[model samples]
Target: MTMTIGILTENVGVVGRFLACQLGIEYINTQPLINARPFKVAIAGSSHV
Candidate 1:
């Protein structure tokens, strides 16, 4: 059997990214990972955030 890993995030942002690279898993969105899609590196909004 394979191990199951997970993460709890407020939104699709930087924290997810680091997880993607290190864990080699897909970064899911608002839904469960089973229904969610993979994510990539993208800069959104202004730097002022």
Candidate 2:
């Protein structure tokens, strides 16, 4: 029913979203991302911090 990818990098996230969208998987809300930096990524359903 859910698939929390647990990653939050722009490029990585783009790839994830692309794959998920193509595969018809529902992206998670707040995917717990560890060591989030450089890419300045943010999870869905949340504002950029």
Per-candidate local distance difference test: 0.38, 0.41
lDDT of 2 by residue, 1-49 (tens): 1234343234446665564565555554245263233223324323222
TM-score of each: 0.29, 0.34
Using TM-score, give the best candidate's number. 2
Q: Write the per-residue lDDT of candidate 1 for residues 1-49, one digit (tens) a residue.
A: 0111233232345565554455555554455453333342222111123
* lDDT for 32 (candidate 2): 25
RMSD of 1: 12.1
Q: What is the TM-score (0 to 1) of candidate 2?
A: 0.34
User: Which candidate comes out best when scored by lDDT?
Assistant: 2
Candidate 1 TM-score, C-alpha based: 0.29
